[model samples]
Target: MRQTLSNPPSGKKTIKQRFLKLLPCCRSDSTSPIIQNSVDDDFELSTVCYRPEGLDKLMQVTKFDKRELQILYRSFKSECPSGAVDEETFKLIYSQFFPQGDSSNYAHFLFEAFDKQKNGAVSFDDFVTSLSIILRGSVTDRLSWAFNLYDLNKDGCITKEEMTSIIKSIYDMMGTYTYPCIRDDAPKEHVESFFQKMDMNKDGVVTMEEFLASCQKDENIMQSMHLFENIL
Candidate 1:
């Protein structure tokens, strides 16, 4: 039987909980500073307070509360003292959770998804924004983000090659941990199955509309989404 979102497997953490726990504890004594500035001239000026860059904006945009943001920020700072994560550090951090698997390729894709700025680095704003959507956004939101990830070339459509690459990378990352042992042709088969459903016009490419419609109608795929949540 397929698992349902309502009934996650026993002892497995929800994506949000798992990510929170995975964050390394903050070891630094320094706190993120709050800036305050005042200027007085002929006219009186009111005091302005500036919280850490993007902190307030993130709170407004994401599901995380102030306390949760504090925890995440502290952890992010601890791991990435320079206030940003490069691809190499990202792969290293991802490898820790799946020690039995080769997480490099999957990590590369994930980092690209999170690097919204396309600057070869992921800032805290980019990190938390993606996390919030995956962990707590509406189904449409999550699916849209997944679509963007699969699009690869930002072409607004998903080709079979792009989907195949994604599936193969996932299988390679899962390695020996997958039960029943994946076959050599498993990635190809998986891609075929998805294309069969998602390529609505038989044009060899899946548009975002086709992708979203098919995914929502497919109960099994929706349930399986939780299984891959740990990849983030």
Candidate 2:
């Protein structure tokens, strides 16, 4: 049976539930107390009401409407009472959704992707902007973001080493959940396959142009994109 976010099996919070905990509008009240109290005491949810400014500007740039933005802001404030999330806290929250695996490396990369300013923190705006792209942006936009995630150095191109690292991190994050039990050399093999199609110029690295063209032209990849729509 397809599990619903509101009723995760075994009372363990699914990735979707952990994700929803960062967006109040869709959150359920049945969250496990163990999970609810997992946040550090120093960063506990505060009773203070935080009103995020620049709703007009955010709406213009992202896909969220005014009401949705407000709801997101509330959720952000609840999790990050200080209006920003540091990398450590971000990793903690992300790790919760993948207890069966070591999500630290993956979380590190994801945190860097969301930390647009490279300021060592993710503000409410930064959070929503990326969330908007992942959950609602156009295919090109989403692909661009995914490319950025893989481009660890922010060097505008993804090398085999970079892709390998990302694939390995993903494997580590999926742990035993990966069907058929991925082989030890799975990450290397995965990178080789990606490079075969993505590095169209035989340049040993995939540029943004190449990545976009390759993915956009692939019917299977386009269809698979929908599987991640609920990941926010």
Q: Please give each candidate's TM-score.
A: 0.79, 0.80
Tens-digit lDDT track for model 2 on 45-79? 34324345577889898887765676677768778
Per residue, candidate 1 scores C-alpha lDDT tens digits across 24-120 of 2211223322221223311221222227556678889998765556656766777788889999999987776656668798788888999999999
**Predicted structure 1, TM vs. truth:** 0.79
- What lDDT is reached at residue 143 by model 1? 90
Model 2 residue 77 CA deviation (Å) reads: 0.7
Off by over 4 Å in 1: 1-18, 23-53
Error of 2 at 2 (Å): 18
How accurate locally is residue 137 in candidate 2, as Cα lDDT from 0 to 100?
Answer: 79
lDDT of each: 0.72, 0.74
